[model samples]
Target: MDNNRLPQETLERVTEETDNLMANYNKYVEQLKESYTNAQKERKEFLSSGIEFTKLIESEETEEKILTVYESYKKLLDDRTSLSKNFLSEINSLLSLVDQQLLLLESSYEPKFGIQTQNPRIFKTNKNNPKRLRNPEDADGPQMNGKYCICNGPAYGDMIACDAFHIEIPWFHMECMGLFSAPRGNWLCPNCRPSE
Candidate 1:
């Protein structure tokens, strides 16, 4: 009887799905670049308007004209700030969606791998020197967020890592992770907990 366990077709689908995912990632990257360009343009506009506002404030002009210029300058600044915040929120949402996708991809193969396979070479490495770090650029990126927390909410306070596993991605919030005390040594999240 087929019990919805990892089907043979699941493995086959992984290859195709990965290709599709790559294409989507490339498209999203282009969108990210456009957002960056727009941000730079907005920054320039803000700078120019700020200079104009400064000049207006310094000029020995009528009070009405000064107040009008100040009002317009404030509005422009607020609009730019709001747009920037919205753009950042969209980027964060995209990041969270990608994380969810990765988790789905991993779950699709868990039945076959038995969730205990020690040979998951998720990190690429040099064959000659096995001890060397697999991803040198990982350290340069932003710290991992609690996107995968069991609570499914934004992480609050300081985040911590598990020593039992390499923190390729953080899985919990400091307090929300349910750990009573800070781990002294190796610790594992529920997903990675060894079945004894």
Candidate 2:
């Protein structure tokens, strides 16, 4: 084994490989730490809260609102079930994210839209605002008149989900590109629907 006889190119290649290996090792270790901590916390909370949630399922429940919420979680779980095939490799990350969202819900945290499920939120509603057309029959249609779908009140726009002040018709966010002229395009906030 004559080190001096080794090709200069070969030595350079080994040095480069070593550096790459160290970088990758550092990245993997950081990722592992994050994964471990997040999983530990999420699993603990899920196991406890999920047990309570499950019990509510088996018992005779009368709260329609709670039942609806449970159903949404069931659906979310079902949608993400296929990811379980990847298990610890991928699904855990996604489940942790969903768990966080659910926890925020449990805390009744409101998004920027200020939507509260307990009380009806109204938008664009007033003598000057457009008339309401959120009835089941017109749900799939325009959803409202004068403005995009308010989800509940006239011209409320999508922000009506929680009560808040809103301009009548053509509620446009300046930063948002292009004018929204249909059934509250995808950018419209569903939570913004006026409930009052």
Candidate 3:
């Protein structure tokens, strides 16, 4: 065999080995590409499914729905609270006005009518004679004579004289004369009434 020329069988074996290596590398590359394509398809499917699931969760009634409902009703709740507070304030103002009026009435007038006694069975009557006529010789003047009344004699406090009856003895205490209501028109005591 010549030194510069390779043997035919050895060349053929080397060429066949190189061809086999290239075929095996091409097969590995094809498998890697197929695997990459499959991974991409799986990723797409996962992403699409995730989006659909998120949409379904959002559409369902959950915390978001509750939040929306709370937002809508918050104004009504605040309005009701304000109205109740205003109503209570008005009622309190009216109560204060009524209390002030009551205080004024108590300070302005003193109660004088409806005298209560301990004994319910005892009837009130004068101890001395009420209709006794003063002697003309003993009489001092008309003013001194008219100072006393038939009922509750001897007018000590405020007194009023009746113009209708008892022209002789007309002065009487307003409370003792049973003039509870305001003194209007001519008033006459019970002792001076004309006998029916």
Candidate 4:
């Protein structure tokens, strides 16, 4: 397997799953809003009917009307409870899925961001050499005196000098090139590597 592909794959999967989770969350929110609206409407209707029943206390139909209203209210309460339970269950399940996805992302986080998880190799460079003078006329932009590497960074830490004789900025940070230690043999920078 290619070293680069794993992080890319994990990133794609996480993005897809996040999109799905957002869609599901939006759907759940809409359902909750509709349920709340319906519940409020039912409660208002129930309250108005109760008030009307007070005026009908002297009529013979009062008992039967009150019984009907009571049953309807009870059914509304049961429906609301059921809806709440289902919503909570779904939210819990979604949360669990999110947690799992987070764990997966954490595992691949370093590689995905090109961060080195292992400790960098500590090595010493020769300190006796004098800094080189920059040539303004150089084709690769104004060369910085004493600065080396593709990053144009100052010489410090673990660095490998390219063996290519004609190369400019021969010194390269091993970390910049994802190297743990200096190569056992002559090393070539990307630009100087011969075409395969």
Winner by lDDT: 4
Candidate 1's C-alpha runs over 4 A off are 1-61, 111-196
Predicted structure with the largest TM-score when compared to the true one: 4
- TM-score-wise, the better of 1 and 4 is 4
How do the candidates rank by lDDT, highest first? 4, 1, 3, 2
lDDT of 2 by residue, 72-191 (tens): 555545544433343334435544554554444434433222222322233222333344444535332223344543322333232323223453433432113233332342333434
What are the clashing pairs of model 1?
none
Mind giving the per-residue lDDT tens digits that candidate 3 earns over 9-53? 445555565566566556655655665565566556555555665
TM-score of each candidate? 0.33, 0.27, 0.25, 0.39
What TM-score does candidate 4 reach?
Answer: 0.39
How well is each residue in 102-168 modelled by candidate 1, as lDDT tens digits? 5655554442211212223121112243343344344321122325356665423434454454544
Stretches of candidate 3 above 4 Å error? 1-65, 110-196
**Better candidate number, 2 or 3, judged by TM-score:** 2
Q: Backbone clashes in each candidate structure, one number apiece?
A: 0, 18, 0, 0
Model 2 bad stretches (over 4 Å): 1-6, 54-196
The positional error of residue 177 in candidate 2, measured at the CA in angstroms, is 78
Regions more than 4 Å wrong, model 4: 1-3, 58-95, 98-196
